[model samples]
Target: MSCSIKPVYGAQHPPLQVMPKGKEERSKTSNKRDAFQDFENNTSDAWDDGDDDLLVMANIQMSLRDVRSTAQAVMENHSKQLSAQNQQTSSVKDELRKLSWSGIPKPVRATAWKILSGYLPASLDRREPTLQRKRHEYFGFIEQYYDTRHQEIHQDTFRQQHLGLGTILKDIPRMTSLAHLFQQKVVQEIFERILYIWAIRHPASGYVQGINDLVTPFFVVFLSEFIDNDVESENFDLCQLPQETLNIIEADSFWCTSRLLDGIQDNYTFAQPGIQMKVNALKELIKRIDVPLYKHLEEHCVEFLQFSFRWMNNILMREIPLRCTIRLWDTYQAEQNGFADFHLYVCAAFLVRFTQDVLREQDFQGILMFLQNLPTHHWQNEEIGELLAEAYKLKFMFADAPNHLSKKK
Candidate 1:
């Protein structure tokens, strides 16, 4: 595997070619030019400011066109690669990983995510059948286990309560309330089913608080497939979509979220040992990479768990915007053990990105407060791409070093 990471920006485009025109075309072009010139002269002085505004608007439109074109080209390239004969081969996965490390284009993000998450087989012939089987299996689980949530016999002996429906219900409303799509009653009902079903199926961890936030990314991405407009900004009626379509989205979200949680299940297990170990690992990692920050944190009696617990438990979902989280997960799904392993490096990079602010804070309270409420509302793909690149660099540098995360003796 190549260690080189590609920059997200700076795609080169071919220049437009000039073709020779016939006499009739030349005459028509000349007449149009003359007419435009006459119009310009007639309105030049009166519409000077309007002309400037029009010029700006034209530039903005051209920029938007270029962006759409680039996104389309990227999506087409991913589709071709994913559809190749050896799509399931390691080489193809590696190429996809490399492409995804930068970012997955939104048009193909759902398919790319399904493939990368190992939910869908690479064989185009088998994909439909697999989806059908998996979707059916998921609904089967729903039928068998979903109704048991209301039964007193299904109550937990320790808590003397039913399944996690209470917690799930509470978290659903709080999760991504800013996005109109998630605010719909139908959307909330789907989320409730997916989370409740997943919790019942996974008995060990059950439903942890932050797990509710994890479902939003998968739900939104899969839901985007059926919607014509952007899921985040545009408000659409879930009633407009067929129940079958909603079922597929729900099942896909459950399976993909399951795939994600599988690698990091220990993070929510008894005592959350996985998260404790990972938070310690993050502390050790930052100590090595930025000794000054580490020592300063230590000197001020700042504990890693104070703020990082949320980071580790929620996978930084609470810290970054949902759009950025989705972009970050594109790379996460592409990487091996990405949620459990690569994410440590990502957290480190995220913390160090705020190094100056952290160091400038004279008190622990100020630093902790600043870290908790980060100014990430305006962040987009570009910022996320940069963060992932830095994380990849960190992984490349320290991943193989056994002592990199070891405690000082």
Candidate 2:
């Protein structure tokens, strides 16, 4: 399924912009005050040592207070919007989609993700019963299929299970090695069971290497419901949690991962025709969105698959930090067929995000190396928000114009 690039006719959009490092921190009142003080000190000679200077400093401080007040109000408004939507008895999906397109507030993220992923019903009345039934059904799967992994009478099944567990075992520790929660033995065992159960159930794709990474976002988000601290960096004793609580987390992670994979399963199937097509789509998208970078790759003989295979395969779980991936998925779940459709635009937006860097690289190896080892380790929710904003803009421009990415004659 090769994708042919068609010439784009309209004026190219402006290059994607990276949000400046420490943009969020710099926006804080303390930092703004410090910056103002520095400015005052640097130009003190220009001001009179009198009442005028005092008045000028007071006005500057007042402006800083106003900035802080405005920022606080915006945050409060977003929080109110999320709370109102989640508390509704009927479907608030359209509102959720709009609010979630930017980002979901952490407190309601778990319930919001469940509803967005189709794991929980939109009606508040049905949600509790549906959760109970789904959780019980998932554990029943554990009782039935999980125990059969060791039954040697079914040699083929045993072999498949063995291989799946082997791969999952190899990948789980490496998935988020630095995350404190994942480093815990209890958490590792939970991940192992979730991956193994999911693999055995979905025989069609049967435990791809990158699938292990997909479970972490769901696991951490659900676990956050039980813990008080940050699940990403905070070290906590999973043993403190009761067995039933752990079971609930494990089951929820499994089913939510299932819902996510259901939309993009072809990305892991034989030959991964879905990812191949997506990678090609991403290339065509970039060709339209940023012509110079596309041409630079072409001139260097750099193929899209060389770098973007991991992007499509893991939905960029490998590229960005775990926290960033979680934030990115908030938008993914909110969009219709987000993982499969909007993700293409995200990849396009992400690639063009490095337009200047890509254009600066003169050779094939340089461009590939730069893209693979991108400096995203320090990226936070603010950066992820900017990325999603650009992705949405790209989706708006080209998603409806299928012929913009259609096969060339």
Candidate 3:
């Protein structure tokens, strides 16, 4: 899909001057002219922003019922798909065989696999050539032999070790300070614990740079929820027992994070294929809905992903404030039918709705910087939720379902 607007580069708007009204009919005529000019300016602004037409555009008719039904069915089918996906596992490979008999679409399953596999990168398995010791240095053998089965346990221990009963206790005061001591010692410590939670749980994917950014909101939210009033208290230990550490070692903390990370692995991939796919998808969606902004971006060589890379990778955590970023994360985590689609819709909504400031950029880099610096504009919660719902609604447009009619016939 492409924009309907003519290509305009660095276009300037003509200034309109309001004229004073004379008496009676003359005054009425002057007022009319002023009103017409104002209306024209408003129309132009709307077009420039790409918001006018789309604001009133009919939403993709997706109901909560539809999302629930689809998600439930997808989850049921996903169990089989996941079993198939994990077929290569030594003991649990049979899970895949069971799913092979299920009626789930292979392509849909494959998409899930693609997204899930990303969270567990090859780097997790291969030891680093350099001798940079990881946090799991304490449990040498378990770290060395880490696999999907013991991930959750590994993560719990990793959290206890790094985040520690002591550090977590100390870190509570820092949450409010948001200061240097807080950022450096406390925030960094907690971040390490969170990263290790991801890393140990995803020993297969291990610690990646961007992941810390991705999980920041989760940590922030979890801390707020779990810590509650005790966040300001001097003694707020998250881990209570050393026995818990042994239990973590046994329970597969690493595997759980791996499963969670699987959906978002593409974000951490160095090759950027996932990012490109998302940008292309957003561009396609925007072109159909808002031609002018699409054309403006294309004309300026401002590919959507250039700026979107960070947002897609970390879901705006790096760019936006914690308050907004966490809310978006909540929706993404809650909706998990591949949060990729929802992210794309939000990107489009921002581009179309915030067109004026975004389009003023002269070059790709400028456009990127503009997007990177994009503030939390005054948008309604309902509208953001609608954009998310629309993203899920649009999934069918991109996803291909398995053919059932041919077999039925």
Candidate 4:
């Protein structure tokens, strides 16, 4: 899939400006032109910040027939078997496994994730105390590990957030729309401290760019655990949140993310062997599934790593909207081998999606461009569901099917 869109470094997506009408449009036209000129020169503002993700909320079409029916199945089991709540864990676990394929409701998502990720204690009664103890340890570790690297963490975190506060505000509309509290320095420190410490502890795989993105989903989800209302609709003030709650959110996010990275530690370790293997695996898998697209890409001299690195690195976060990513993760979290194994199938599905268009691409540059900026601009809930189905089918058909995960790409 070659494109004639020209070579633009780091242009993750197309320009997001929605044209206005009449007099206001005319007045802003000149200003808009200047802005776009600056965009061309720098390309910093081209990063997809997720403001566009909000519109897809209305589009989620997860099958509710089974999912809705089993919505509170876990809660029901917990209440009914209160005396030996942990005893009925077998049935509850079975129910969670069945129900998670569709998606977990927001209210129960945090607890479900904890159970699935192996972060929760087997004794149900000990979860709260464990959470408190772990959170205390996390904050304590911050003083021990990050006390010396505070300035480095601050700079690294901000650079991760599109360079700086002023830059994040000026460039990424998504953060500004969320609230001003996100840009505060203390808020940044929480994330930086957690990531910095984790990298220090896990010397095998230090901090990676996409690891920062991985933290946000968990942070927001766990933070939702403390709040009762719908976090997406409400305008919750971060400043008003208690320091204790922030501590819990930060710590939980860290541990859950650590538990997550444990499975795919190779992805960030020593030259990122995990991604290299995945890219090779993806090319092999694609060749089996969509031979035409694979041949087309090969014809154009587009290497698998050219575009698949983003696919593997971001775990489809850069490709799909956040709403879809959370839903997708619900299923991914449910399976013990979901993120490390199932994610490859998701990458395959996402790759073959633009088969016809990609095949039509006549040059290597065009193919690389098309692969980078996948046509997911108008995707919604239904599209995500369909994509997952395709990924599932791929997994079903190809299990360790890519041939022992070839090391020599």
Candidate 5:
């Protein structure tokens, strides 16, 4: 079988999975080869005439148009959300919350994330000044921690020993830079500065290996908010942006990331109590839900921590595509106490999504490898919606109430 490559799509519309032209050509070639080998004398009907190839391409384009049409609901929701009556209305908030669970429209995702993260000030009067103050403060960090050239040496390995960090991560200093346009060197500098400053201020929970991964979602979301063009269709020329605008994006991302980490800080502190607890919770939940699969894992002596450390650390950002991660985060931010609790359920759903393939692998190495590289590049909005729906259903079935994770508690 040949590789199924996903098409390069625009961000103005929702992701619609399409095959790349190169892959299509390869498939056509493969079909011709099969036709020749299978029945050389009477293979005209069996041979690919390219008619099927045309239909496949046509179907993919139509699917894209459908996704675009579906996103119009978010546009309408944004307009409704602007109504003064909808500002504090429970009905309005409830509707917004419900819509976000499935997906937030790209037209209003930035505003929705701010509202969900509690980063946006509720009082209309305080919004601008609050933003200005935060933006200025962010630059203050740049001036201070980032004064020297970008360096990767440990600040004090003894301090890390004193903190007694239980887990050792390779290349802990550099974090995930989600956007591809930024130069690798530039991205490294940006994260090093921000993370170093954050670590110094927090003291209790300084820069950790996975913390870098946490920053990407916030950065990409906020960058989308600031940049006029879709990042998918065009490259982000960081130098072109006004210094002030760039600073604001950086500040917004930093604060939002800090806010998220605030709730889950226990996970990163010494020994990672949150992760240990989560691993146990996940094992228990899986045992209750899928006994045979749990048994299979147990038989292989495959510890959940071996596979799940990165999952908890990165919030599954590494597992799925960036576009889908945005959609997943929308529901997560919408849920009450989402990051700390609801995320556990999302993980469960994600694991079960590939249960059949996972179960097929009996050995520890096979199962481990299969999970680390889940086939997600070709997944589109439909797949994401279904995943969230399943995740929500799992949350509903297991959680104590409408907005809680029962097993985690």
Candidate 6:
């Protein structure tokens, strides 16, 4: 008697699935293999055909055109999230009340306490220029000398700690360069503990090195605010601030950084596939819309991917001065999700603005580096902002052309 068996995708076979035990089983397997081979051949033919490229390109262009309208939507979203606008003055007072100035180191505590109480002097001498200057000097020194070197060393340490595991992170600091007594082991432990709090809070994006640098200011800012919280309103008695400050920073760290990362995170993971997608999409857009410049760059080999990764990942923060960085961050936070569109326009603007010298360059690497070192002055300039606005306007009007299409037909 003939017999056969056939494989099934899931549970509970139908009555038709029952087959003879021997010859039927062999025929069933052969049929299944033939079916899979047919599927593979058909899929290969569809991809090899170039008919799908134009439709795909059109959809990409169309979405880019919608960027301006989307950006406005993003701005409106953030405007609605500002919950404390009416109580800005009282919020400042409440933040000050929670801090315990004495618990921090002598100098930071002293200066931080003054800022907390609203006793900051209006005028400034060299010896006491202003509270702002001191904070700058402190953070600046740490950034230039210590943070720079610490990355070199701690990167090795981090690899040793997390390597071999799939979850191992290769990029982390060997040592954190904290300022003043905050650099001491115990104090730094507290800082690390707070960072762990932040990491756990942001499970989606765990701790990263630059994150420490970003959060340091928030820690200092909140520490000062919380000083008043430790003291009673009537007698001003000293006590610990609420445990919630840690939680608040944890939660807000996620929210604020998430907003910041929206435009930038693509650079890190997209280094190859993702970055290539964006750069290629931009190229397709330029080819269709701005042919002359596209030909010029293609001749020089200055693909958008080469320069944009750094711009988007760092949000132009590391490349620019701290004052400029903070101001940009303020605007970015204010705009919320629209920052992604704004960031893309800024990238396109930089390319277009530098088109003259860039086109003149002969080598790919030279033009690439030129874009990388593209003037921070340009980024800070008002004209650059106008260019960004113009780019956004264009994108909003025409972005949807390349967004909807089927690659397979």
Top TM-score model = 1
How accurate locally, in lDDT, is each candidate? 0.82, 0.82, 0.49, 0.73, 0.71, 0.46
Q: Lowest-lDDT window of 10 residues in candidate 6?
A: 163-172
User: Which of candidates 3 and 4 is the stronger one according to TM-score?
Assistant: 4
For candidate 3, report its TM-score: 0.46
Clashing pairs in 2: none
RMSD of 3: 32.3
Residue-by-residue lDDT tens digits, candidate 3, 8-65: 4222544443455544456466644464444556547534554545433333467999
Across 285-336, the per-residue lDDT of candidate 6 in tens digits comes to 5565566778977787676666665555445544554334433433333232
Residue-level lDDT tens digits of model 1 in 1-409:
7696544321132223345678547646664445444445554554554454544444344578899998999999988986675644667678788888778988899998998888987667889999999999999988877766566655662154234577787888777645677678898888888887787777787788888899889888888898885454336777988999999999999999999899899998889999999899999999989988998899888999998999999988888888889999988888888999999999999999999889999898998899889999899989998998899999999899958689868
**What residue runs in model 5 are displaced by over 4 Å at the alpha carbon?**
1-95, 144-179, 182-185, 230-234, 401-409
Point out the higher-scoring one by lDDT: 2 or 3: 2
By lDDT, the better pick of 1 and 3 is 1
Pick by TM-score: 2 or 6, better one: 2
Error of 4 at 235 (Å): 5.3
Instruction: Give the TM-score comparing model 6 with the true structure, all chains together.
Output: 0.42
Ten consecutive residues with minimal summed lDDT in candidate 2?
A: 8-17
Task: Return the lDDT, model 1, position 41.
Answer: 56
Error of 4 at 321 (Å): 1.0
Candidates in order, TM-scores: namely: 0.76, 0.75, 0.46, 0.69, 0.69, 0.42
The regions of model 3 sitting more than 4 angstroms off are 1-187, 193-206, 229-257, 362-366, 377-383, 386-409
Cα lDDT over the full model 3: 0.49
